[model samples]
Target: MSNINDKIRQIAKETEPELIHIRRELHQYPELGIDLPKTHEIISRELHKIPGLKIREHAAGGYGLIAELKGKKEHGKNVLLRADIDALPLEEKMESTYKSRHDGRMHACGHDGHATWLIGAAKILAQLTDEFGGCIRFAFQPGEEVGLGADTMIEEDKVLEDPKMDMAFAAHGWPSVESGKIGIVRRYAFGCVGDFKVRIIGKKGHASWPEQTIDPIAAANEIYQHIPAILTRTISGTEPKIMSVTYMQAGDVNVRNIIPQDCVFGGTMRAVKREVLEKMKTELEKEIKGICQVYGTSYQADIRIHGGSVKNAPELLNGVKKSVADVLGKENVYIIEEDNLGGENFAEYSCRVPAVYMFIGIKPEEKEAIPGLHSPEYQFDDTVLAGAAAAFANIAIHGCMGELKEN
Candidate 1:
């Protein structure tokens, strides 16, 4: 086990140049959502260079790529290592040489680093295929920002097919943690995310005549005021949950004397448990409908429930904890009891197999604090790339070969 870890660390160091170039190239040319043509092209081109691998593209319009490294030993369980490839729709605010070339598009979530780590894992795994005895599938999925890419790839049977994945694992770059440190929580660390769009219908009339018509703006305000109460009442004490109203649109611009007939509201809810989430949804809908009825208005809620809480299987979580301790040392890994409210599409992989979603610390040294992800100013310390690559490679090798038992 020590020998394999040493070999992985050495291989990661040797592949440093390639990893840097891959990260820079991806950062410079950022694509958004499920339409990552250029991103897919670059990933496919690089993976095709590896020997004895079968590559397939399954994302809608060539946005996702899957590469399978066949095992030397026959009939072994399959495992998957995934990385998201899509960028955010934000203008690059940094002054780095590899800044986004595309206007209003950037890899603000550290996905470039994620892709680079997976690629590093692929290269190291290709070299150690003889030592590893099971199949490893590299999934470069798109549209993780909007939370639909993984679903699309799964529907297309990209990651879990034929040989079927026995387990899956992925990592995100954590700007909050210092470089050289890694954080692994036993799944369900992050909460589920669900988006909703509400439309309220009412009668428009002159503002001067207050009693002449039902006002949707008033109804929207009421709904917004009612959300906090809903959250406090419906969400149980067993799990953490949050509901927020983020967007509201109504009425005509620059029109002072008119009451708008329609109002639109959009928001999201986060919950740690599935049952709590279901309860929240049911209660929210009923409350909104009742409120609208009281105001003599018609209300329709178009709720699109997406990414669910990431629940790591116990076995996989233990294996990852061991792997992190082996690569980054024991003190660097910490178990977080409280679940993060942010949602990650990595949860989608849990549906197929026991999966682990971990974080690699990339906080910069000079800055007082690292910027939060999805912010235009967010950046990762490149020095963490080596550790990340080593961690991922070790997990892949040990996971596929089931070497943790030997340790």
Candidate 2:
């Protein structure tokens, strides 16, 4: 165990420079959503550099790549490590030389780092095929920002098929924790996320005469105002849930004297529990219908309920605790007691196999705190790459050896 651990650390240290270079290169030419041709090319070129690995490209479209590394021992359980390769639609705000050249697109969520770390692990696992057993599947996924990547890959690419993964894992960079640390939480790590858009159709007329036409704008306002109260009353205070109206469109900019005929608004609904989420949806629909009825307006809603909360299977949870503690040191590993409100398509993958997703700390100094995920100012130190890659490599090696057992 100690010899393999030492080798893992050494390989991670040696790969730090290359990993940083790849991450910076990825940051400069950031791609958005599942339509990442250039990004796919770059990833394919790098993965091809490693020896003794079989690589497969997405036959349909988009930037989905799967690499399989076969160990010396056959018939061993296959494990998968996933990394999202899509960037956000935000423009880079940091003053780095590697800032995104493409405007309105940035790797603000540390996905670039995440992808690089997995590559580092791939290099290590490829070299240690003799010592380790089982197959390692590296899933470089796309469209994670919009929560469509995992489902598409699973359905179209048949990612979980072929070798049939026995276990899977992924990691995300967190700015709240101190640098060089990691966080592992049991059970629900992320909330269930769903999107909704409401379109209200009303009679358009002169703004001066409010009584002449039905006002969709008034109806939207009423519905928006009722959301907070309804959520508070329906879900318990201890439970975490949110319903925010992020995008609103009603009137035209050129015309101010007349009311617009259409009011379109959309937002997200997130909850830690499925029952609470269902209740919120039902109550919200009723409220919207009632408000539109009173205002004599017609409304239409498009709602999509995605994967639910990401729950770590009991076996994987305890095994990963030991693996992470072994690699990052017990003191640097902490157990998170609270649920993160963010959504992850990793939930979809977890439902099929035993899975665990942990966080890597990338926070800079305390006095000069960095921005959080999805924010324009968000970025992480490149040095954290070595530790993160080491942790992942350690898990893949030890988990396959059946060393990651419950105490």
Candidate 3:
């Protein structure tokens, strides 16, 4: 075990420079959505450089790629390591040399680092095929920013079957923890995501008239105010839920003297549990309808479930914790007790197999204030990529060697 750890560390160290280079290159040419031809080209070229990896590509649903490394010792069963390859539709704010070259497109969520780490781990695992058994499937997914990556990959590519996965693993960079640290949680690592759109219909009239019109704006305001208060009374305080009204439109911007007949609004809701999330959705729809009724208005709604919460399998987590601690000392590893409301498409894979989604700390040492993920100013220290690479390699070997219980 110690010898394998030493080899993993050595290879990670040797590949650290290349990992950083690849991350920077990816950052420079950030692409949005699933049709990332250039990003696919770059990733495929790198994967081909590693010997004995069977590569598969998907272009219909998304720019998905899966590279399989057949083990020398074991042949049938497999393990999956996934990385998101899509970026956000925001412009880069950082003035770094590797800043996004594509206008209004950025890899602000650390996916650039995630993709590079998987590539580095794939190289190490591919080289030392004799060390462990079972196949290692490295999945580079697309459309994660808008949240269709994992489902599309699974449906279009059938990623979980054929060589069927025994266990799976993935990681993301986190700024809340200090750089180079690893955070693991046994349950509810990420929240379920739900997107909702509400349209309030009312009669339009002149601004001077008070009782002559049914104002949808008034109903929307009431719905907005009651949403938070109602959730506080209904949802348990222990469970963290976030409901945000991200977009709203009422009347024409140029005309202020008249009330528009329609008021349209949309937002996102997140909860740590699937049942709790569904409850939130039901409550929200009911509340909106009730408010519209009072205002003598009609309302329509569209509430769609994006992704479910991610829970790490307890038995697999124990083995993964030992592996991570073996690779990056126990002091650098942390067991997170609190659940994060952030949504991850990796939840799709975690729900399918005994999976571990780790958080790699990437906060810069010199900065007192760390930038949040998905923000235009978000950035992280590139040095954590090596440790991340080594830790993932450790999990791929150690996690598959042990017997895992199905979820």
* Each model's Cα RMSD: 2.2, 2.2, 1.9
lDDT per residue (tens digit) for residues 92-205 in model 1: 798998899999999999998999888888888788777777789888988888777787777765568777787888889987777888877654757888878899999999
Error of 2 at 74 (Å): 5.9
Mind sharing the TM-score for model 1? 0.93
CA error at residue 133 for candidate 1, angstroms: 0.6
Model 3: CA > 4 A from native: 59-62, 74-77, 403-407
> What overall lDDT, based on C-alpha atoms, would model 3 receive against the true structure?
0.86
Give the clashing pairs for model 2.
Answer: none
How does each model score on TM-score? 0.93, 0.92, 0.95
Query: Candidate 3 — worst ten consecutive residues by lDDT sum?
Result: 398-407
**Which lDDT values do the candidates have, in the order given?**
0.82, 0.84, 0.86
The alpha-carbon lDDT assigned to residue 166 of candidate 3 equals 83
lDDT of 3 at 403: 40
Per-residue lDDT over 19-83 for candidate 3, one digit per residue giving the tens place of the 0 to 100 score: 89999998898888787888888898899999999999764275778998877875435889999
Clashing pairs in 3: none
